[model samples]
Target chain A: MVLDLLASGLIYSSIIVLGSIGLSLVYSIANFANFAHGDTMTVGAYAALVTFGAVGGLGGTVLGLPYGFFVALGVGIGMAALVAVVTEKFIYEGMDVGSIGLLITSIGIAFIYRAIIQMGFGADFTRYDIPAMRPIDALVTYGIRVTLQDVAIVASATVLVVGLHLLLQYTDLGRKMRAMADNPDLARVSGIRTDRVKLWTWIIGAGLAGAGGVFLGLFSRLTPRMGFDLLLIIFAAVILGGIGSVYGAMLGGVLIGMTTQLTPILSELGAVLPLVPDTWGIPIGIEYANAIAFVIMVAVLLVRPSGIAGEVV
Target chain B: MSLRAIVDDPNAYWSGLTRAEQGVSGFIAGFVVLLLGGLFTGILAPTYFLFLVGIAGMYSLLSLGLNVQWGYTGLINFSVAAFFGIGAYGTALASASSSPVAGNLAPAVGLFVALVLAAILALLIGIPTLRLRADYLAIASIGLAEVVRIVILNEDQLTNGSAGVRGIPTFFDGWPLLDTFPQTMPSVAVSWLPSGTVVLGQSFWSALLNVVVVVSFIAVSYFVLKRAHRSPWGRVLRTIRSDEDLARALGKNTYRYKMQAFVLGSLIMALAGVFYAHLNLFVSPGDLSPITTFYVWVAVMLGGSGSNRGALFGGFVIVAIREGTRFLNAFEFIPFDVAPLRLLLIGVIIVLLMRFRPEGVLPPQRELIWPSVVDDAPEQPDSGVRDSKAGESND
Candidate 1:
């Protein structure tokens, strides 16, 4: 039972970590909470669907393995990046506004994107054309079942995080980006091109958001409102990890993912545990799972507003 | 001024008029719209359209509540719908039968309890969150609202769960006015009206009563808020909004002031919710979605945030747009669903407005004129006038 919980928790955390990285990066550099990041993830999933349709025969299995999934993933990431860049250039960059204005604009952008998705796709759940993979029972001796798709998600997430770390540490562009995030005016004074850094920020942040969306879609069915559903959870993760730290976002995502998955089991166990009465069980069903993120976020803010790794404002 | 001059340059037209002249013009314009809308819908359209107007009045009250928090105090509250839901469910449960799940109280008592509950809820939420930065407060409040909604959705016995509570007693069901006023009245129809003749019936009377109740709510709240806005208390709120640090430096106890504003605004929202519940004669979780909160935000932004009159006007405009689109939806030529399109247009409008005119249609009045010369002390820089001026330029 514990193994099953851990497997599901890991799957959920993989997607959350991907999404939170972008959110935290944007908050750090852009100096505003981008409410539309979740929708951008939805955009990525839809982009993958479009790509799969456009390249039908090419998506067929090769050597008894699905090779087309990789193509779709690349397309999803690129298309999501394009969407983010376009929005930045057209909407965000044109406005010389305050953080509040930016925040409001992000909300407007969220509405526009979600509405467009609804218009184009209708309010129906969709899925990728990729074939479903069977669970590899031989990999584990325990009763817990882990699917090949789950493995893919974990592997891809690990690779992405490592790649991100390498890029931030070893690359000049990454250093410039970090410098700007730390202090934009100082970085500019030190001859860093803040505009170019901002562009890269959107690209990298949105690329990861798109990847997260694709993974989430693989885990479940795709709906127009999927991004909105996951929005608060992503916010909780970003806020928990600290607003500006990528490493914090990763840790926060895993923690939130585990909490959301395990809380119900822990509450159910109250019935069997001798320490408490059977009636001491939590009355709230799993419907409260989404709300757990919010409760944690509020509690965290009250106790420590800067987040675990965030500097005091 | 000539009509052409007024039409050519509205800013100049507004500038040319005295404050009293502007006030009279605004009142006349509002009266004309109400009269025409009432007559047109009462005669031509079904009674349902008038119902929409009454709902608009409720929304206006919500916008006014939001204006006090977001506009006057610059506090971000994404949880208006939660307070609204509380007022609705509280009133419904209080006035309901004494079942195993709920209480049975009088409607008046229910309203009072809802108000108190909303105030207490606001105080609790504000105590923890108000000390944080604006965005943190925004995140926390939105989360708090979601938590409330989840609880309401799951606690079936108490709130009737997703099925919601029905058979809610209307405010006027046993009122003296219902007995005193005749249910039907003969009326002449205009030549342009679809119906050549008209007879106002029971539904019309009920609708009229609701309109009166809602309009009175708006008027009383408006006058009260306006008075508060012009008072020293209002000045302090504005100062807090413009520069919290300055207000704190002056020993204003900014936290306490903010908490008061939050509680007062939430109580007002709860009152609006009571009106909503009684008018609709039902309460449901579906009625208190985040979208409703966003709708109020749109109204507040469109009308002008800091201005009470602007909030009212914004509410009216949103209702007009919503009903107008629904009316348009009957036509067969439109290719796509009108609802999503309307929302998209609203989003675009908001983006454009934020980029171009964040101050809204009615910019907040920078100064209030008094006949007495001694009133000048309140308008000085010590009140954070310079900060507001800088904010305007930034916009």
Candidate 2:
């Protein structure tokens, strides 16, 4: 049972990390939390779902692999990239003239983005069928009975995280981005081609957000409002871990994932208690179980403001 | 860099405000915002006047409370809704338990008790949460707000949770009547304009009565806070807003000052809740959502930070726009089926306004009246300068 929960928890962590890395990146470089990051994820997920429905599932496999997943990933990435550009130009660029100013502007722009999504796409939930996500459960017993899509989420998350780590730490572009993040003025003074780095930062950041959105869609289902809900959780993770630290965000995500996933399952034990679950729901209230992890974020921030890893000055 | 270059830029937007025409335009625009509000009420239902004006008044009270924290103290309070809700509940229960006749433990006493309790609650929450810098405080306060709402909702005994409280007394007694004549439908008001129509199961006159009470409360609050915001105490607050460290260095106990501002602001908000309870005559957990907090923020931002009148003005305008647009379904262009579009429109308008115009339509300038300035005496160096005149005191 422990292994089962952990396995499922790992899948959620992957999704969390994917969405949160962009947030972490934006905070590290942009110096303000992008409250709207989750909305972009929503925007990307919808864009891909709408696009996939238009195409004939990207046709057959290339070299015997399903091309449909890539089609989804490509569409997700493409949409994320487009969204990042538009938001940066219209929303973040002008208002975020100062770092902290960006924070407030992002909140407003988030409302706008959410509004547009609310207006155009409407406020209903949706889902798309991923054909390749089947038959994985047969391979493993005591696997806590996760779905095929759950396994895909885990695999995709691992690839994305590892890929992002490599891309951020080892690549030349990554170094330039980091340099710019460290001191935007100095980066520009040093002729590091800061604009190129910023553009890519948003591209990668939003792409990850998109990937997170896709995984989230897989994890549960799609709704116009899925991003706004997820945004708060993801923000808690980034802030709880440390601003701008990818590894911290991943760790934070896993931790939050476990807390939310495992806590309620443990709440059944509250039922087992002599008088607790039936009378009080004590130790944990299962009805508002969703509010549990966010409370933890607040508690963590109150106790430790710089987060788990202190933010760089 | 020289302080001269930093402090007074010849071509600064603020400098342009020192020009007489701009100042006249500012006052005109301010009046225009109010006129627009009256126009909004006229176009919709006149009964909507109560809702619009009441909401603006309500938002003003909340923003006033926020301004005390953010505008004066440079504190980031993301949980304005929670405090406002507290005020609402606090007042509702107080009024529910009030008796009109007894001078001591009577209706006025109930109000006093609610106001005091609300202040205490603000301190209780603010002490723990406000210790952090702006970002963490923002997060923690937001968290605290959520926690409180969830708890109130969960505690169905004290609060009705999502169902909310009802039948709280308006407490409009004891104050002398402003409209000395017996109330009646106006002799010449537009027809089909809800001027004398039944609304929300309430007679237009009764709703108008509620609006009058709420507006009066707001007006009184505006005067009191406006005075306090300009006083020596208010000066210290402005100092804290501009530079907490500087304020602390200058023999000011910043923490106590912060606590005082927070509590006072919260008290005003609690009163707003009291107003809200009477206005809606019904309260629900729905009214205490995070959205409410942001709406207040939008009001303060849209009006002008630091200026109590501006914040109050913002409160009314934002609420009117929101409520008015939602009520626009009365016209054929919008069917009732698409009324869900209200949230989307509000979100878009707020975003566009904030993004394109962060200073808001009526950005806070100096208190135009000398009396408004006299009490607020620390003498802000060129209040018209840009870059957060309220939040960044460097002296």
Candidate 3:
């Protein structure tokens, strides 16, 4: 039972990390919380769905995975990036507004994005065309069920995280991005092209968000509100990791994922445990899963508004 | 002429006006609301539309509540729906007798309890959150709202779960007229009000009572908030909003002040919820979604965030748009679902307003000029005006 929870928690952590990194990045560079970030995930998922529909015949299994899946992933990433850039240019860039204005604008954009998705998707649950992968019984020997999809998700997420770390540490563009995030005016004074870095920030951040969306769709059903539903969790992760810290976001996501998953288990245990009262055994139930994120966020804000790994306010 | 002048320069126009001029403007605004209500009841002839207006009035109350926080105090409260739900469920649980979990109290007592509960909830939420940045408060409040909603949804024994609590007693249930009017009144007397009036017999008095309750609430809240806005406490709130550090440096217990504002606003929101529950004659988890919070935010923004009158106007505008779309949905010629489109339009409107006219229809008035001061000094160099302008430019 512990293993099962851990396995699911790890999957959830990866998806959350991908989603939150973008949020942190944007928050760092743009100096505003992009409430519409989660919707970008929804857009990515829908993009994948559309791509899969268009390339049904090209989806034959390769290495126990479909080729169409890769195409859909690519398309999803591309579309999310496109949408982010377009919104930044048209909606965000033109306004010389304060953080509050930007924040309100993001809320507006969030509404618009959800409405558009509903308009296109008809507010129904959708699934990708790929056949469901069979769980590998060999991996279940340890009392935890594992599937090929889970393996793929974990492996790809690791690869992506490592790649991101390398890019940030070793690359010139990454250095510029870091500089810009540290201080945009200083970065500009130092001859770094801030606008180019900003554009790249949107591309990469939005791309990762798109990838997270695809993973979310794999783990659960696609709905118009999938991203909206996940928004608070993403915010929790971002804030918990300390805003603008990529590595912190990863750690925050893992912590949040594990806590949310394990809380129900613990609640169940309370019911059966000899020392606990019978009435106390009643599990808090899964409906409170989202509430866990909120509680954590509030607790964190109260205790440490700067977040665990965040710089001093 | 006064309308055009007010429209052209909302702040300066109001500030420059005489006491009589300002009263005229106030009267005109009041007249407009009454006129709209008259149009809904007298001409539209649909009892349903009147209900919509009443609902709009409820939203106006919500906007006013929000204005106290987001507008006057500059606290970004995203838990409007949460407090609203609390009021509703609190009243539902208190007044209900059918539900096993209900307190089975009178509706009036329920309303008082709900208000207290909402105020307490706000105090609890505010104590920890109000000390943080505006964004943190926003996040926390949204979280709190969701938590409340989840609890309401899952606790079937307590809140009837997702099925919702029904058969909630109306506010006018105990009225003597309800007992005597329907049985004693002739059919011709009932029909005398109007053809399509839903307020017939007992319902007529009930509807009248509801209007009286709602309108009185609006009037009382308006006067109270206006008084608060002009008082020293309101000045402190404004100071806290503009710059908390400065307020703190000036020896104000900014935290306590913010908490007070938060609790007061939440209490007002709960009051609206109580009215909403009685009006709808039911309470459900679905009625208290985050979307309703956004609707109020939109209203607050559209009406002018810092202005009480603007909040009221914004509420009416939002309700008109929402209900207007519902009315439009009946038309067979229009293609596609109008519901989503209405939301889309609202979203667009918010974005556009933020971009172009963040100040809203009536830009918030800086200060109520005393007649003596106005005559003595036609143009007082008010620092508040300068600060407000700075705030406006940033948006």
Candidate 4:
């Protein structure tokens, strides 16, 4: 049972990691919390959904996902990037208000994005046109019931996250971006074109969020509110890992995801584990999973406001 | 800006107002006239109009609460709905006949309990987040709201679960004459040429009483807020908002002041929720949605962050948007769901309002000196720079 939960947690963590990296990136670079980031994920998911529906499965499958789905995923990433760039250029760039003002504006932008999506695709749950797959026969024998698609999600997320790591550590743009996020004014004084770096940050951040959204849709079903519903958890992960720290966000995502999936077994674990007596258990329902995550977030804020990987205040 | 000035030199007082202030007065005058015209012509049923007024008053109360937090102290509380819901559910559980936890208590008890609940919640959330950056509060508050909602949704025995607590009595339920006042009132009908005869019955009377209650709540809140906004305490809050470092350097406890503002704002929001529970006759987990929080946020921002009167104006505008979109379904030409349409309007308004006038339509004009001091001073300082000299300076 533990192994099965771990496998599912791995899948869930991939999606959260994708989302938190982007949010942390944006927070560090843009210098404002983008409330609209969740809706940006929604936009990516729907865009991919539309693309997948239009381009059939194209007659082949990889890891239980159609080739057309991968095409759709790429399109999703591109569209999310494009939309963020446009929003930055037209709406955010012209505004003179400080970060707080931008934060408020982002809430408005969030509403607009969600409203438009709801208008276009009626507020209903939808899924990509793919056949459902059962747990792999070999994995089920070991109580690790993960499907090929789950493997695919984890693999794709790994590729994207590692690619981001390389780009941030090795490339010139990455160095420039990191320097700009560290201190925009100092980077500007040092002759870096901050605007260009800021734009690239939005592209990469939003692009990763897009990938997360697509994977999330594949993991479950799609709805207008899916991204929004997941936003709080993603935020928890981002904060736990320490906002603006990419590595921290990844660690936070894994821990949060595992906790969420393992919630149902908490009472059982308490009773069975060595540290606890037989009758001592927290008999909480699975529905309180989100609540637990939020509680954990608040606790983290109280215990260590800077987050695990964040610089000490 | 003072009643004495208007009374002493009416013409000078009127002339002294800025064009924007004059425009606002004119707009308000026209709106009141329009509402009255609609009533006489039977375009609006008296009870429905009263209900609309009650809702507007509720929003105004909510906006006022948020103004105290965001306007005065620059704290971004995204848990407005949670506190509002606490006030609602706290009261509903105490008083609702269907409440599985407790039932049939006096509404006054509910009100007191609800406010206390809201205060506690404010502290619980504020203690952790208020000491952090503004954005952290925003994120944490949003999380707090979600947690409250989840608890409400899953705690079936305590809250009646998703089925909701029903059979909530009116606020005057246990009072003597006021308890049965609606049923005791006689029905009246007035004939109007345009729409037909309008009948005012027990429903109308009850709704009228709700309007009265909400209006009084609004009046008391407005008065208190106005006083606080012009006091030395309010000045410290405003100082914290503009420059926390400066305030801290001066030896003020910024965290304590922020906590007070957050708690005060949360209590007011709870009052609004208590009113809503009584007026709507039910309470549900749906009442705690994040959308409600954003709606209040828009109202506060659009009303001019720190301006109480602007918050009031923003309140009525919210009711218009909420109800106005429902009217679109009657037209048959608008081929869209009203929900998304309302959202679109709110989004567009927020974006446009921020883009054109981030300071809002009626930004706070007066300097934050104590009212008595301003009155007692021998010479008046130049108020023009603070009020009318520049548009972006205040922001």
Best by TM-score: 4
Candidate 4 yields a Cα-based lDDT of 0.89
Report the alpha-carbon TM-score of model 2 versus the true structure. Answer: 0.81
Question: What's the lDDT for residue B77 in model 4?
Answer: 91
Expressed as tens digits, the lDDT of each residue in B199-235 for candidate 3 is 3454544555566667878888998999898889999
Candidate 2, residues B1-395, lDDT tens digits: the string is 24485477745645545453366456658856865665545554556655666676777778877777776667778877877777667666655533222222233555676687687778778888766767667766777777778877887667756666665655553345523222434433444443343233334566667677677777787788878877888889888877888988999998888888888778877787777876775667777788888777777776666767567766766665676566576678552335446555556656676567666656656643455355456656566567555778867
Off by over 4 Å in 1: A57-65, A131-134, A139-141, A269-284, B1-46, B97-100, B179-192, B197-199, B368-395
- The better candidate by lDDT, 1 or 4, is 4
lDDT of 1 by residue, B196-216 (tens): 446556677677777877888
**What's the i-RMS of each model?**
1.1, 3.0, 1.1, 1.3
Summarize candidate 1's per-residue lDDT along A57-164 as a digit string, tens digits. 464554223566667778889888999999999999989878888888888888898888877887789988666776676846675677877888888889999999
Tens digits of per-residue lDDT, candidate 4, A15-64, equal: 99999999889988998888888888888998999999999898889999
Runs in model 3 lying further than 4 Å from the true structure = A57-59, A62-64, A269-283, B1-44, B176-205, B371-395
lDDT of 2 by residue, A118-144 (tens): 666667877776543443456457656
Query: Could you tell me how far off, in angstroms, the CA of residue B102 lies in candidate 2 after the best superposition?
Result: 20
Model 3: lDDT of residue A213: 95
How many pairs collide in each candidate, listed in order? Answer: 0, 10, 1, 0
